[model samples]
Target chain A: MSVLVYAENADGKFKKSVFEAVSYARAIADQNNTTLTAISIGNVAADELSALGQYGAHKILNVSTDKLKNFINQAYASVIAKASEAEQADVVVISNTFSGRGLAPRVAVKLGAGIADGAVSLPDTGNGKFLIKKTAFSGKAFATVELTSANKVIALIPNSYKVIENATGAKPEDFTVETNESDFKALLKEIVKSTDKVSLPDAEIVVSAGRGLKGPENWGMIEELADLLGAATACSKPVSDAGWRPHSEHVGQTGIAVSPNLYIAIGISGAIQHLAGISSSKVIVVINKDPEAPFYKVADYGIVGDAFEIVPKLIEAVKTYKASA
Target chain B: MNILVCISNVPDTTTKVTFNANNTQFNTAGVQFIINPYDEIALARAIELTDGGKGAVTVIHVGEAANEPTIRKALAIGATDAVRVNAPAHDAYFVAVQIAEYVKQHPFDLILTGRESIDYNGSKVAAMLGELLDIPSVSIIKKLDVDGANGTVEREIEGGKEVLTIPLPFVAGTAEGVAEPKIPNMRGIMSARTKPLTVVEPVEVKASSEIISYETPAPRGQVKLIPADDVAKLVDLLHNEAKVI
Candidate 1:
């Protein structure tokens, strides 16, 4: 059973997270005594395609279709079913990004496969049983799920797996995928970027603030710190609701959940809703005037102080450290 | 403009999660169940789309009798009727098949669901339903407008948002900022009791996946309290010890 990994690309470039998924698929393929194949849609250079070989893909199949460019879910899922058929793949690995969340299940249904989403680690294949660990209860808990289906689809949670980049280069093949006029029916008219700043999903560090910052006007220091640290800026629900930040920046139960390596919470009380989003974060740093803020409870480090004063000092420290380095 | 909103019954966000014997079943002893928060936004949007009694908004839940209260809550919030598929929602594939089968019989011009249930966080059913129904499906949508048979939507993509237009007989998984939830008023709550709550047997579909066990996350370690004024120390720790910077 050959394994297939869907490496996602944006603006004709492969995302770093996609390689992580390919690396994961690589290990699974080797353990099963089978070679893995990587399928990328739209466009990428021949070198970029062969770069996936470092993650141990035996071949790279590029479905260079103009119709497949804008991420129409139905259209994209169709490409996957066709590729899986050609590759004789029994397992499909995908990065659990925004597109993965939209694309994986549809592919599973088309292939009659049992799908697992938000997988935190590689599957355990031993004693004639395959078990996958996935974050359940919104990140509150993890569930060991067993896919009984022969054709299985797994979307690896981003940042959980590290990509390996030392392997033989895979041969790149341009495969033609058939599409009907209806494939382009649901079109993406335009894309409006939220910011040129680091995207939230892939950001290693995130600087987030809440109502404690008072008003939108007070975001100066928060933005300054995020810019200095090269981190994405996020907000609590109330802050976004009040238009102090875009709703896209809201990280909580009702917003975009994040799992960065380092998540710095400034002037935000950690409600359960907010906590659920970042519980997976490797390290949490919280700054709040109220020492009893619930966020401090889950934080690895805490400072009881005003964010306005603290953030500026932190920004200066980060600036100096960067300059010295 | 007939609209169908898919609702999921999940534990409240604040519920302290626990497992039963061998972690096979979720111990639902005292845990309160509410309409999944994301689904609430979709339900609210569905109600507004069918406002002024222009059309009907039907709520569908794929769970056992235990979800009756949550289904009723949807009716109270302003759905015309409710349907309960008699079965446990084992996985997204199972739930989507049941809803797809049910909806094909009682079709609606538009369908809505939360981006994903907060519990499972699968974010699958909507697209599966769209595929099953062969209609356009949009995810993470924050705005939708239906004029005549055409629909316009704005959905969040990776680093940005996109606008798209699709015809009627479509499915959409909504996110927050779509609409404020309608807390059932006294009249609506009273009327919800009289509103129809139909229980239907689930369509037989094999689950592709099964849960072997469940585990809560590891507990947080002791927090290292840094002095309020020690900015350099924190930066030093991040770079040298934590190595995050």
Candidate 2:
């Protein structure tokens, strides 16, 4: 029996989220007394693939499909399923990323394994049962779910598990998996970006604006502050709908949900849907002209003022601090 | 063309979530319900794609009968009709099975749903249903364009967006920006009252997962209210207390 993980790669490097999943699988394998193996797609460098051993993976199964360079959910899921069979994996772990979110459930169906997403913890095997804690109701509450199926899948949310590097020097083994040509139906054709700034989902710090910012033309200060702080720029749903920001940068219950390390909300009233997505953030800071804005209720820090006036000073302060240090 | 949109009835965004003593069930009393915001996006897109007239845009829900009002709201928002699969939403697998079984006979050219339900955040059914139906599935789509049997979809990725060509009879779990969710106007609500609502029994399927219990997260510490003029102190605190920089 083996604990299998799908190590996701981007720009020819394993992402932090991938390492977190491998670290998670490492602990799971140790507890279950099983070897932990990982599968990755495309022509990832052997050294890069082997680097995963630092996270306790015993072997790295490499599927070198050129077309796998793009994020094709179906093809990736198919390869992961085939790799599971090759490794005889009992527990499959993946990070709850964009690709992981689309791919994990398909893998579960293909492997006939019970699956859980947004997992926040390692499985508890005490009492001879497998239970895992996962976010429920969009982070408002938590639920412990029991997977009764012999085989199981867990998709850990990004940043939920801390990565511990243990240099085991795991070697890479080439594996072959055939993906049906028809499985490429929903393939990525092209990638487009509105800004070169750090994307919200991958960002550790996010500086977001809202309708109270007044209009899109006044976003220079917001962008300046985010750039000074090395943070991504985001907006509330209304800001996106009103064309103040691109829809890709919106974070709410309906929009992209984020769990950044530090989320600074400027001029936002903190709608419940908006708060749901960011409730898991490590630390929240709110700046609003209205003292009664709901965002301050959940914020770790609050500043009640006009963002137009306060943001520039904050940016200057950050610049001064950086210059001194 | 028949487009099937899956809608979920969830507690309104403002509702405070709580649980029973054993945490076996959600404490839903006194809470209002609405069509999931993301699902409303899917439903609105389906209506837009169907031109609001010719082809049918049908919304379906797998839930207790009490969710019919939510279905009616979907119809009022411009779905041609709706189907209520009378079953407890036990798990993603069970719900997917019911949808697969229902759609196998009905045969829709397109299936749409929110990326994930607001309550469970499972995000499982679309792909599972796609697998069970032997069709393709896509997620995180921000735009979908359909012409005849061919369709193009744009989805957000980590740092950018990817456009894809998805064929017909495929499942797509939509994100926001697919379309602005439509609220029911007076005429639409009047028309929705007469829209056909089909009821079907769920197929026998066992839940692969079960919820053990629920728990609330620990309360956050009090916020450190900083004066607006104290930019230096705010930065100092961020470096010292929050250490976010």
Candidate 3:
């Protein structure tokens, strides 16, 4: 049996998260001593489909149909399930992105496979059982889940692993799934792209502020710092709830959960819900006036000071460093 | 319109996560449970959508009798009635199967669930129910509006948002912005006790997965406290020591 992975693409180009998912699947394939096949749905260039080979995919199944031009959860799940069955896949992996989150569970139901979403670690096949570690309780804790079903589905969290290059030079073979009108029940009416400087999920560094910023007008320095570092600007739930920031910019347990390489919190007291969302961040830096702020406990670096005074200086320092380098 | 909102009772967000019984089970001692926050949002939206007797909102939970209080909270918040499938929410598959079975006998025009449970963070129930019932399912919807027999929903993607239209008899996992949660007023709380709270035995279904154990996150190292005045030093440490900048 082979391991199957759904190679998600955006506007015909694969994102870094897709490669990371393929890399994770490759490791699992190696562990199981099986081949890995990646399925690409919608319209993707031949070269783009072949790129999956770089991530250890022995074969790529390209499903470029006009009917499936846009992402319909039901249709995409049907396509992935069909591809998995055709390949005799025992394990199916998908990136835990927004689209993948919607598609994975449906695929699991269609295939009658057990699923573990937000998986942070590869399956531990020790003792003849498959146990996978996943983030639970909104990243506050971890749970090791055992998938007893023979066919299993896993949604790998973004940034959980680095992408590795393994050249397989695999060619893309055309794969097709029969579709009826029912698959298109959910019609995509329109798409609205955010004009933000940097997307939070894909950002390497995130500059987030809480209500401690005092007012929405004081956000100039936070934006300046984010612009200098090419980072996304996020806010805590309170700030968003108060209308200081858009709800999309809110990062916390009840909001968007992000795990960037570096997360810098400015004037944000570490609420447990807010901390739970960013605990997976690689490095955390806290800048607050209160030393008793709980954020410093989990931070890699802490500076007890006012954001108005400290943020400008930090921004200038980053500017100087960039200029000098 | 009859709406079905599925709720999960989870530990309060502030509870410190811990494990017991050789790490095989969550330590429930001295911890408080509440309706999952995301599910609360769904329930709130369902109540708003069915406001003024336009329709009825039904909340269903798959858990033991101990979670009845949580179900009552839904009714207090404005659900027309409640149902509890008498079983533990062992896994996503098992829970979805139980809900689907109950819904098969008692169908609804619309079904809503939280984008993901705060405890397991598994966004599986809505889509699974969609497949089992042969209906379209959308996940993590930020906005939902009903007009006639069709509903419009907006959901965030990686770098953008998408708005879609689906006919009635569909499922959706609600996120923030769907509706602000409503608290239980005294009048509503009093009336909730008289509202129907139906308990039914769970259908025969085998869980496809189980949590083998639970573990807390590794403790972080000591923070390197830097004076606020010396921002340069902190920047240097970030670049050289942490290599993150």
Candidate 4:
């Protein structure tokens, strides 16, 4: 009864979310009274791979191959499944990011394992059933899912768990799996990255706006505030629909759902659909002129005034606090 | 090109969620159902891909007769026909197996589904279909273009995007930027009434997972309202009380 975790990385470096996944996997491993082994698929340096041990990885398997440079969902799933077989792993854990969402189901199918995606809580194993709580209806509700299969796969939602460091002296062992032409059929031809801004999914703090901002021209203050706070920028559906912001920046039921640490809404009336997406945030702050806006109902803090008047003052205050601290 | 769009009938976005049956089932006493929003995007792109009588767009669902109206709405939105597997979508694996069994007898060139259903929020069917059928699958693609026997797609990564190409007879989970959903015109609605609505028995497949219970998020407490003029005080509160920044 051993557990395997996929330590996902980008350009050979691990993200904070990856450490969080490892930490969550470590807790599950502890619960099951099993050792945790982490698998890295890309070409990561040994020193960088060893950082996973700080998050409670007992051992590491490094599978470095030129063929696995870019993420191909099918191939990655196949590799993870093969690793599970090699380790005789009864449980597998992956971060429920964009790539993990694509890889987990296929891996489950390959391993004949039951999966619980978007899992927010650790599995309750005391009742002899591995039941886990996960977000459903796009964060509007929660469902407790029971995995009945002998083998199980869990996709942990990013930022759902804290990254706690535990010391270990684990080393990496080279692991390899056979691949064929079928794995490369869906060819990843190019990658386009937006270099300047923080990605919305990984952002701890998000500054968002809505239709009340009026137009795209008035977005300077929003961007300035986001920049000062090192936060990602997001907008409501109407703002994206009217082409004021990119669709990737839209946070709602139909858009990119975010569960950041701090979500700041300026000039945005929280519609039910919009709230369905962001209701999972840890803290919410609303800035709007309308005191009766639905957003204030869910907000932790609110300032009822013109965003134009409030945001600049907020930015100045943040700047002063940062300098003084 | 023949395209199949898999849709899920879900509770409307504004429905207040509740549970009954010992908190094990969703209470549907007053809930209204609609085509899942992401699936609508998949259907719209299928219709666009097969426009001008180039091919057929068949919409499918795994549910009982209670969901026929929701499936019919897809037909009204430009799907050529519809299919409803006469069984509850027990789970992602069960639903995927049923669809794969039906498609085994009747195959399509391209298959599309939403990134996930709003109800289960399981983005599993597309990948499961790909694995079961031994074909390539891409999830959450923003853009798709088909030319001859090849398809190009742009899929979102964590902080960026990746462009990939796959052959025909592939499965893709469509996302928001794929296409704009089309509203049913009066004529389309009239025609949808006469379109074929086929009901088929589901194949036997064991569910790998079961829902043990349902829970609603805790209601948020009162908001600490700050004076518009007291920006510094708000900052102090954020720094001390909230500790988010």
In candidate 2, which residue ranges exceed 4 Å CA deviation? none
Clash pairs for candidate 1: none
Which pairs clash (backbone N, Cα, C closer than 3 Å) in model 3? none
Q: lDDT tens string, model 3, A1-325?
A: 9999999888899999999999999999999999999999989999899999999999999999899889998999999998999999999999999999889999999888999899999899999999999999898889999999999999999999889999899999999789868989888999998865788888889999999899999999999999999999999999999999888889988888899999999989999999999999999999999999999999989999998899999999999999987
* Model 2: per-residue Cα lDDT over B1-245, one tens digit each: 88999988899888888999688889989999999888998998888888846599999999998999999999888889889899888899998989999999899999998989988998898888888887888877889889888789887778888888888989998887788889899989999999999999989985679999999777788888899889778888888888988
**Model 4, range A11-45, lDDT digits (tens) per residue?**
79998889998898899999988989999998899
| DockQ scores for all predicted structures | 0.78, 0.76, 0.84, 0.82
**Candidate 4 overall Cα lDDT vs. reference?**
0.91
Task: Give candidate 4 regions above 4 Å deviation.
Answer: none
TM-score of each: 0.98, 0.97, 0.99, 0.99
Give the C-alpha lDDT of model 2: 0.88
Candidate 2, residues A1-325, lDDT tens digits: the string is 8999999887678888889899999999999988999888876898899989989999888888686777688888888888888889989998888878889999999898999889999999999999999998888888999999988999999978888987788799888777798788775677787568787888889999999889999899998999998999999989988887888888877677788889999999999888878888899999999989989889999889999889998999999999987
Task: Name the lDDT value of residue B129 in candidate 3.
Answer: 95
Going through the candidates in order, the fraction of native interface contacts each one reproduces equals 0.77, 0.81, 0.86, 0.82
Please give the range of 10 consecutive residues that has the lowest summed lDDT in model 1 chain A.
A180-189
Ranking by DockQ: 3, 4, 1, 2
